[model samples]
Each structure stands twice: as C-alpha cells, then as structure tokens.
Target: MKNNLRGKIREFLASEDGKVSVKAPLTLGVVTGGIFLAQAIIGPTSATACPCQHDWQCPNPPHICSVGTCIGG
Candidate 1:
C-alpha cells in the first residue's frame, strides 16, 4: 500500500502538471508572510474613555465629568 502511494507520488512529482513554477510559490509565500507580519505588527486595541472623573480620563481636556460622562464644564 505504501509503495503504491509512493509510486503515485513519484509519478506526480515527475509530471509537469504537478510541477508549479517558482513564481506561484514565491508570490503565495510573500503574500502569506505579509499577512502574518501585518497581524503580528498590529498594536493593542485602544478603548476610548467614556465615563470619567479627571480631565485626563475624558476625551477632551475642556470637559469635566458631569454625572458619569464628561461634559463641558
């Protein structure tokens, strides 16, 4: 069974149909690598401050916390 599979693999590898040109694999590898690189290099998700007390926690420094949200003082 293994030998038959091996023979078939050898036949496929020897055939021109199974042989892909260098550019296809290179382009695929480059695109795949770029996607992975982009994912890895992406920064942490920054959540916008909604409910605040101090001016720093508010979206704008001109606003102060009124009730829960920051509103213009």
Candidate 2:
C-alpha cells in the first residue's frame, strides 16, 4: 500500500497538470509583487480632505474650502 501511494505521487509529479500546479503559485506571487512594487513607486493617488473655514486656508491652488472642508482641485 505504501509503495502504491509513492508510485501515484511520482506519476502525478511527472504529469503536465503537476507542472501547472507548481507554476500557478509562482505566477500569482510575481504578479502580486509587481502590483505592490508599482504602488510603492507611484505613491498615493488621492488627496486627503482637510478641514477649513475659508479658501485661503487651503495652501494648494485651485482647491477651495467648501462646507468646512477643502475640495475641488
């Protein structure tokens, strides 16, 4: 029974499906790593809304204080 199980394992390892089983995780890891690396390099994409009472309080141009929050630009 032990020998039979060993033979079955060996046969599975030699099959094309076994090759794909090994490669799939490797491919997924590489893709996931690449996405993380890209995000790290690119930095944050959105600006955080800051509390403000007037337009001038918002330092960056084109942004304006509206409803006590900085928005638009």
Candidate 3:
C-alpha cells in the first residue's frame, strides 16, 4: 500500500500535468469576493436585518441586530 502510494506520488510529481493547482491566495480572494459580491447584489433582507430596539421589543423575534437593524427569525 505504501509503495503504491509512493509510486503514484512520484509519477504525479514527475508529470507536469497535475502540479498546476489553484493558488491559495487567489482562491481565497475569489471566494471572499464572491461572497461580498453576493451580499452587495442581494444586499440584506428584512429577515436578516429588522429595524427596532430590544430583542422581544423588536417587531420580529429571535432576529439579530446590525447597526440598530435586527436580523433573524
């Protein structure tokens, strides 16, 4: 089992085909940018942000508050 795995690794490294993997920073940036873009495009729904004071006092319950806006159930 170990020898087979080692041979496969050596073969993979010897070949120029599979070594070109995505860069970590680029991948992370792309993912983060995608999330940010989605948020910007979709923005925040009332379900995500409800305007009010206090949890129960707020019109909606179990919602999170962002900059005085509540978001949740």
Q: Using Cα atoms with residue i matched to residue i, what is each candidate's TM-score against the true structure?
A: 0.32, 0.41, 0.39
Residues 1-73, candidate 1: write the lDDT tens digits.
9999999988876677656754467679999999888867984334333566566565555766676776774
Best by TM-score: 2
Q: Compared with the true structure, what per-residue lDDT tens digits does model 3 show for residues 1-73?
A: 9999999988876566544543455578899999999999987665425455656544455664556765676
Summarize candidate 2's per-residue lDDT along 20-72 as a digit string, tens digits.
Answer: 79667778999999999998998865544456788877758798888888878
Ranking by lDDT: 2, 1, 3
lDDT of 1 at 70: 69
Model 2 lDDT at residue 42: 88
Could you list the CA RMSD of all candidates, in the order they appear? 8.5, 6.4, 10.5
TM-score of 3: 0.39
Determine which window of 10 residues in candidate 3 has minimal summed lDDT. Answer: 17-26
Which ranges in model 2 have alpha carbons more than 4 Å from their true place? 1-14, 47-73
TM-score head-to-head 1 vs 2, winner: 2
Error of 2 at 28 (Å): 0.9
Q: Which of the numbered candidates is closest to the native, going by highest lDDT?
A: 2
The TM-score that candidate 1 achieves is 0.32
